[model samples]
Target chain A: MKKIIALLLAAAMMVVAAGCGGEQSASSGSGSGSGGKQITMGFSQIGAESEWRTANTESIKQAAKDAGINLQFSDAQQKQENQIKAIRSFIAQGVDIIAFVPIVETGWDTVLKEAKDAKIPVIVVDRDVKVSDDSLYVAKIGTDSVKEGNNVFKWIDEYMAKEKKTPRDGGSQYNVVVLEGTVGSSVAIRRQEGFKDAMAKSANAGKYNLLASQTGEFTRQKGQEVMESFLKSYGPKIDILFAHNDDMALGAIQAIEKAGLKPGKDITIISIDGVKGMFQAMIDGKANCTVECNPLQGPLLMETAKKILAGEKVEKLVYVDEGVFPADVAAKTLPERKY
Target chain B: MDMLKKFAGSSLFLPVVALLVLLVFNTIFVDGFLSIQLTEDGRLYGRLVDILNRSCSLIILALGMTFVIATSGIDISVGAVVAISAAVVCTMIGGRGDGVAQMPMALAVLAAIGVGVLCGMWNGLLVAKFKIQAVVATLILMTAGRGVAQLMTEGQIITVYYKPFEYIAGFLPGMPLPTNIFIALAMVLLVAVLMKKTSIGLFVQSVGINATAARYAGINVTLVIFLVYAFSGLCAGVSGLIESSLIRAADANNAGLNMEMDAILAVALGGTLLSGGKFYIGGSVIGAITIQTLTTTMYALGVSADQLPVVKAIAVVIICLIQSKKAQEMFDAWKARRMSKQNGKKTSVDGKVAEQA
Candidate 1:
């Protein structure tokens, strides 16, 4: 008990010291305001996991450098604890504005409260953190994962029609093998629910169906393995492959190739996250379609940061632009791609 | 009935029975489940090869665990050891480079093994020196070791770029077989030779059977305990190397996570006495395959995720009962009565003949 108390006292002291230091930094911040004045922008990333994350990190770094803003970067590494720690650190840093990609929907009450306590405006990007009150964040900028799923299905309907294959329910439904994202993740859960809802509500209900839905954890290997099993147990049964993310979709494609089968021609593959790999997959005619989930949050976040720091009213939610891209256009759009 | 009553040394029967039941159940209830494809591609897709690949790591974990269990010690930290080795290999080795540039892989492998040994030694010191329970000591290292692995890579996966390291989990030339499977098989034979063909194996078993008796017999009990944990670390280090190669990246959180459960379950199902004494290398190998097959089939048949634990629990429970005292007693008593009845008739006849004489 004494040891715990001592630890708590130490932690309290650290927090107070950090808070004081943050105040000092905020007073002498460096960022580009209206007249080229130095300002500060705090950014928190949802920890690194893959090449995509590295790209994200680089994008933000370059953005911060080019914008001449003092970027207070925090790598959460996909942990709520670490993310919370970073947020608290940002609060102590007292940057003019804050931006972060939330790892999960919940568990932001305490840290957001800290941000609120610090009187700093927060901008949400990539992923949204669930809060009881929307007043917590100044603006939220991200793609609609549900609409992404809808777009995939919409393309699938056209693809199936061109293939002249009757849906399993005799043109009423098409059986789908769904590779879901991590369980309890907002993207995975919502995207799955959204796709299910869209498929059910589509005009040709018999043209869309669900065979099996499993968590691939948004990895290529898991996606490949799951796809293989689906092929085994439900051979000739799965008509379409629906992945919650591009990574799993890519994995499924690998599994398909390993099986000595063509992916797009045999089984329709549709996914979100218009990553370069997905575009390459489209260009090679492996993946059928993709829904773009923009990763570049610099401009949108910067805009929100400026507004919040300037004491101007910003919209509570800012849905970023997102749309479906067919394989036909992949080659044409490859050069213009920035992600 | 009397013939059916024998089960003392038999360990494979229950696990096999449960496995068969699950297979049959799936064949019946799961839709299109009988679509059993015998093609090489089909089996490969079904995880036959992947399971074999995973078998090497599992066997290493089991081999290490065997000595630990034989000495009445347990190490829950092998899972975290996997993460540590993977991170070391990925970050230290500099990933996917030429032979000279791939020095980090070799260094990482050595570091991982060294680290694993150190972890085992730490556990050993706690159990042999400070008299801590093996379970508690290992559990502490389990959490802390994972924390260490996460700290090493800063929670980022460093993708391996070297082709040589890829061959660790990739394939053997021309055989279309994973290299890890062969490695695991070689380790199994090595473990078997170590335990059965050597005095050290007997010494460990004797110590486990009765530590006091072993001590009176002049056996160094503490040394044996320490040896067991260190051996466990070596096994975990090998497993970590294979696993890192498979993913081509050192993901601290996911690599070798929940592996301890699989290893423990494999050891238990192998009928190795968890309390200590007598290792079953063959049984452990079979147990690993059986569990892998069951997992593969379950996922293949579209088993609902919510009900996996329940099914696993029920299967485990049934297997335990089949090999339990209650079931054995019922069979034993029946056999005893039948044998006694036949013997009574024979003895009466013999007695009558003796009276006539």
Candidate 2:
């Protein structure tokens, strides 16, 4: 009986091994067939933690199909260790190119060095990586939070000017209150710095009084709670409300409406991340403007990957083009928003 | 004076005093903190109302947590269960451009609560039948429940545009208070009556104090443990409905995030021991209110968001110290020493007078 059991176990192991071997050979055979040798790219994603992230993943997948790149996608489920494991596996699989959205800023030097040694070009997408050697990755493709923040101020300035109520021209002082994102996050810090820089540089800098600023942790619930207290303390004195993200702004709009005040007219609301919900809010006249930090980087990433594989020199830092969407244009753009 | 001392010695004393102190501080420093204005929509709007309105969910969560803790078990999965419930409700009521429900609204809510009770039953099965540790059992659901919710929502934030659905968390026509306040009150009353009228409370206490002993005393220990967890899941399910309705969306990632910690803290602040035995329902309710008031107070005082947690930690420490029996004993000892010192002086003076006579 013992001998028979051992034989059965050995047979099971052989069958499993054969199945894995068949899968690998079939994948490699298809990779070489097409028009020419298809470029196999292994891309590891930081999990779908939010709607914005899911849209970003969709764009990348769609772009890969459009660009005719053989994409090997792995989800890290928002863990750095899992991301590292996926990168190591990609190296072992000997993919031509490797890419990942690093969940954190640090702790990628070792796996990246391994990829560099394996002679595979690595691309960092979305959130950046901090490695000892910059040459480990060929290029970084993502949005610039600082530029997005600067654009917010510029859009507000343009909107005020268009209304013929330029604060620079000695118009009424606007009491601006801010709902910041999670404290200590790089995006939050950079966006805040960009806003402050634009404010200092503008002629109407002194007219926009910052009444209060508090962290809303970039959630609808916290945003509403904080906005409720802000409404009670500052009352109708607040003329402008700026949230670090659209979710917080959406939450604040609810609080504003509950307080028997019109959001867009009573308090000019501006926020980042032009999500679909935010566009709907704009159409409803509850929000004023949104400076998009675009998540649709699929085409750019695939194009960059093709350029690098073709041995063309590419810029190390590539910024995706984003635009400002105000209420007037929100109606036209709402239907087309893929996110 | 003795009555005052007795009141101070009660478990409810510390949380009540903490809440009063926070309210008094806000009244003194925060402008118009005490004033409640009738909005044009006929709703009462103020910091006080906001505290009550916002804390309603937490209060409900704490009510369930009180019973779970009484059984010497913790439901860390309450937060995840909340996410799952929200996902179930929101997906059932599809986000149509027109304000229409895919299914009956009542059925959707009942299904959400039913899912929550199912989750709790799974936890109860693991702990009561399999003899697994409560934390480990609940942790399984805590980790997997969010993923389940994400799957239900298809990794999307399902925004419910049904106008009538708003009344779950928002105001009904011409109502002065948010519907959530009434929902919370009804839940509390239900739990209060269950504990007062039924022997389930006593059975839970016996099982918590000693399960083997309780079984020997002809108590159904397994059933008591199972029922507490089910009740806790019911509370989380109701909370999930309120939360999802508040934002009109099922955010699988953020809905009821870290709320389990807040619920556990509320139970602790109510002077309930983690080891399980005696319990106080009203104290937990007051503790929930105190926490919300503390948060509102920090916002009103203009504390930076990064610094808010630190302030809250300090306040919690102070309240816990005030509730500590050792601290009260030390205070009584100090008072006794002062009284004895005065008596000693008088005795010495009398001795001197007797010697002179």
Give candidate 2 regions above 4 Å deviation. A1-42, A47-51, A61-97, A164-171, A306-313, B1-10, B334-357
In candidate 2, the second chain superimposes onto the true chain B with a TM-score of 0.92
Could you tell me how far off, in angstroms, the CA of residue A50 lies in candidate 2 after the best superposition? 4.3
Fraction of the real A/B interface contacts present in each candidate?
A: 0.34, 0.79
In terms of lDDT, model 2 sits at 0.87
Task: Point to the candidate with the largest TM-score.
Answer: 2
- Cα deviation at B283, candidate 2, in Å, is 0.4
For B285-306, candidate 2 gives per-residue lDDT tens digits of: 9989888888898999999878
Q: For each candidate, what is the lDDT?
A: 0.73, 0.87
lDDT tens digits, residue span B1-357, model 1: 554555423666666665567667666766655443344543333345545665678777887887788787788999999888888878777643233345655676788778778877888888887889988988998998888998888755555656667678766445466678888888888877876667898889998899999999999999899888887888888888888877666768777888888888778777788998987776677677766666666676676655765776776677566656678799888877866676677755656444533
Q: What lDDT does candidate 1 reach at residue A111? A: 79
Instruction: Write candidate 2's Cα lDDT for A251-291 as tens digits.
Output: 89988988888898878899999999899889889999999
lDDT of 1 by residue, A1-339 (tens): 997788667656644554431221221222124466665677778766655566566666666666566676767656778767777777776777788888888978877877887888888887767898877877887767777777777777777888787643344567888998886776787787778777788887665667898777787656766776776666566678989888788778866765556898778889988777677778878998888876665666666676667788877777656767889999998777765
How does each model score on TM-score? 0.76, 0.88
TM-score of model number 1, chain B: 0.81
